[model samples]
Target chain A: MEVAGLILIVIGTFFDLFGTIGLLRLPDVYNRLQASTKCVTMGTCLILFGFAVYSGFSPAGIKALICMFFILITSPTAAHALAKGSYRAGVQLANQSVCDLYSDKQVLKISAVMNRDVITILPDASLRQAIDLLVEKGITGLPVVDSEGVLLGIITEKDIIEYKTYGNVETAKVRDAMNINVQTLPPSAPLKELVSIFSQEDFRRVPIVEDGRVVGIVSRKDIIKFLKEEKK
Target chain B: MIEFITGVLLLSIFLALYRIGMGPTPSDRAVAIDILGILVVGFCVIISLATGRDFYMNVAISWSLLAFIGTIAIAKYLEGKGFDE
Candidate 1:
């Protein structure tokens, strides 16, 4: 029995090793996570099972069993954390991504604070790409625009979550998927006004428009940062 | 044999620590540190078994709890909120 247990442990170790290698070698974050999570989890469980058998009814076996239970609880949680981290970090998926999971239709037509530039997205942009942009830019919202740079709708993280519940499917297009009506703020608005907006409204972000075009985007965080810098 | 395995685990812990320290983003660091904590728990379990100690089992349990609490706190902080949030 002990000999059989040792063999199981060895086999488990090999599986874990291969998983780690896959984690290191995978080209994209999503694929890496998929490989590592499945491999390491199953590998670790088998190893613990082996240890349990090898140690028999002694305290060692009990300890091994407890460890296995803990692993079972935490491994998938860890994978969830990693996947969210990758998404929040703006890690891009490879070529096959089709759906845009992070766009909001309500807040399209955004203005950038740094050069007063506008962020526009087409209907066909994948949800993954939109999410990647949000993560990369650290922005809370974006403007959904058509090929003519005409504002169609807006998308935000909240929209993404809502959409996920609306469809059991993963595929969605921005034009068919965005909120048509959007609220806007002009560049001439005062800082105090922006603060009032936050207090009075549920939105965390707003677009600053000038001359019928987006010039800058302002968020609650940006306002807080501005105040902090001013205090210094 | 135990010593050899222990040594290898330590090496992996160091490598994981490096990732935590050098990760470009907050999430990367958070994940690495969390994994390292799990690895530490694994080490404690192994040590308890090898040494035939009931005391080490208690220690392992305490360590696991502490690590869990720490991971939760850090994750909350990363999310821009505290326990209440």
Candidate 2:
């Protein structure tokens, strides 16, 4: 019995050694956590079990058993708590991480919220028609498209009003008044990227483009509404 | 024979200490501390057996309890939460 117990202790110590190596060598906190937790549990439990076998039914032996039992319950719990806490603390994963299942709720895709019923104007249309479209649809901007549905430019209420200030709003074509340089996004872009774009001065809406055609549009209100829905 | 077991346990404890000193993140340190605590319990039992004294088992049990509680407390701190939660 003494021999057997000693052998178990030897094995347990070996596991402990391997665990420490893993803790030292693993790339990130999360990987180290799994390695250390499993190895430590095996090492300590075996050592305690060895003590029980060597001592038999004495008070110390029974206490070793109880201590081993306590360890069994608590080791995994501690590991779980540590993993959760580390993630909540925003500890980033290693550079080569292949999968991340935890951050999905926080990072949303643009397709989840963008309006598909895109209101567009022809570039050759009068600026008055773009203004009417903006007011009739209660939208701030319109993507100006060619006959082939390829985006030419974007016209907003501000554009017409600015044209009225310096140019001829009534006579100006949508091509004349429209801002050709506008921000666009792919449907797969993350909400984080959208937030940065919307933060720019005088930026309110962005068009979602697919195949060089305007597929949808997203405004600040869409993001605000998405956030409000998420809260609920 | 008992001396060798005790030596191995001591080595494991040192490894844990090495991690505690070297770990970059607070969570790594906490894990190292936890492993250290568990190793100490085994160390206490082996010591008690070597010395033929039973009181070290009591110390072992108490150490395990303290280790579990301490690990949990550190985890809560890392979670950016109050201990009361």
Candidate 3:
């Protein structure tokens, strides 16, 4: 039991160290904020849990658990309020940042006769390359992928265009600018489901994922093409 | 094991303190302070465990509560508001 407790403590300590490194190293404030809060909170909670395990259900362990509970509840709530407050207070990214949330329309103007190849950007690719892909491909966004073609996230033209951080946004890594929270679909889903999903959000495209890798993308134009074929 | 926990917490405290000192804006500092408060609770627990006492846990509990309240207040201040509001 003591060994188990020691192991948990050691792991939690490592988490805390990594989070601090992220806080010290990450270029942008938003990234720094998220990395620190996420890792630090988890680390501290784990430490408290370790103490509980070490001391058993005695008063000390119980107090440790109580502290852990307090931390788990309050930390995230505070971070959320802080994030929203920061955004509203105009604390942009590390540079002159803006989140033009309302300005762009999700107009998927690609022709129905589309190539199925899903364009992707590497995590390490400069945001400049991402912009070029968007412009050259005449598309609004591209999914970010690992070497294995695994879907990581999506970067839109808007993300790079307005992001003034770390340097010229062009020089910044796509990993920083890309939106990790992307909507994706499996090819097996029904077309009606796909259409309904498209109608639900402002994103112009959804990468088709199979076994965590991006195989294709579905855009508004593809939906239109599907409708045209159905009419026959 | 306890020594390792102590070292980690000490390092974390310094890092958070650095953030507070060098944080670009008030909000950044507030975040650093928030992190510091939570870290302190863990520190108190470590100290109590090492010292063979239960009083330290009491301190931890109170400290945790106070830290949460303090963070809430600081966050509000960052948003440009008074404490009463």
Candidate 4:
């Protein structure tokens, strides 16, 4: 029994040694956490188990068993907490990381939830026509486009209301009331970026442009829907 | 025979100390510290067996408890959240 226990202790020592090496050699915090948590925990537990075997059913043996159980439960939990905290603290991943499952699972690209069948109005179109389209389509905004489908500007419900309150609605064109300085995002933008933009700028919708052409649009409702789904 | 195992545990502790000294991040250091704590418990157990004194086992038990608590505390501090957080 003593020989068997010694063997186990030697094996555990090697495992512990390798775990420390891995902690030093791993590229990033996450990878290091993986090495130390698994390898060291297992190694320590083995040593405790070996000690228990050597001491038999004595108090020392029972105490060794208790210590092993404590280490087993606490070590992994603590490692998990640390890893999550480091991630949330904005520690950058290693450059060679092929994929980030955490962010990938939580964040969807703007293209994923963007409305591809966008409702757009021509710059030359009348305000009356723009309003008719807005009311008929039940949308708050429409992207203004040129004949070649290049984005010109955007007209929202607020623009129409402003024109109604001040300007002669009969003589107004969509270009006269549309916001020329519109904010647009690429389809590749992450949902987190979209959330920040929406919250900071209070935009009702943002146009998704590729090659300077409006390919899709994402509204506040779309973002809310996506977030609701993520909660599940 | 017991001396050989103690020597191995001491070597393992030395390796863990190197990591703790050169670890790039707080989490790495925390892991190293945790390993060192486990090794200390192992050392205590080995010493108890070598001397035929069961009292060292009590010391080992307390050392393990302290090590576990220290590991969790460091991890929590690194996480920058309260226990509930």
Best-matching candidate per DockQ: 2
lDDT (Cα, tens digit) per residue for candidate 2, span B1-85 = 7777777667778888988998788888988998888888878877887898999999999999888899988988989853334
In terms of docking quality, model 4 is: acceptable
- Model 2: residues with Cα > 4 Å off, grouped in runs: A105-232, B81-85
Model 4 TM: 0.56
Q: Give candidate 2's error at residue A111 in angstroms.
A: 15
| Alpha carbon RMSD to native, model 1 | 17.0
lDDT (CA) per prediction: 0.62, 0.85, 0.77, 0.81
TM-score of each model, in listed order: 0.47, 0.59, 0.57, 0.56
How do all the candidates rank in terms of TM-score, highest first? 2, 3, 4, 1
Q: How many backbone clashes does candidate 2 have?
A: 0
Residue B39 miss distance in model 3 (angstroms): 1.2
> For candidate 1, what is the DockQ?
0.11
Selected candidate, larger lDDT, 3 vs 4: 4
Which runs in model 3 stand beyond 4 Å of their true positions?
A95-232, B81-85
What TM-score would chain B receive for each of the candidates shown?
0.80, 0.91, 0.90, 0.88
Q: Given candidate 2, what's the lDDT at residue A174?
A: 91
TM-score, candidate number 3: 0.57
RMSD of every prediction:
17.0, 10.8, 14.9, 13.0
The candidates' interface RMSDs, in order, read: 4.1, 2.2, 2.5, 2.8
Worst 10 residues of 3 chain A by lDDT: A106-115
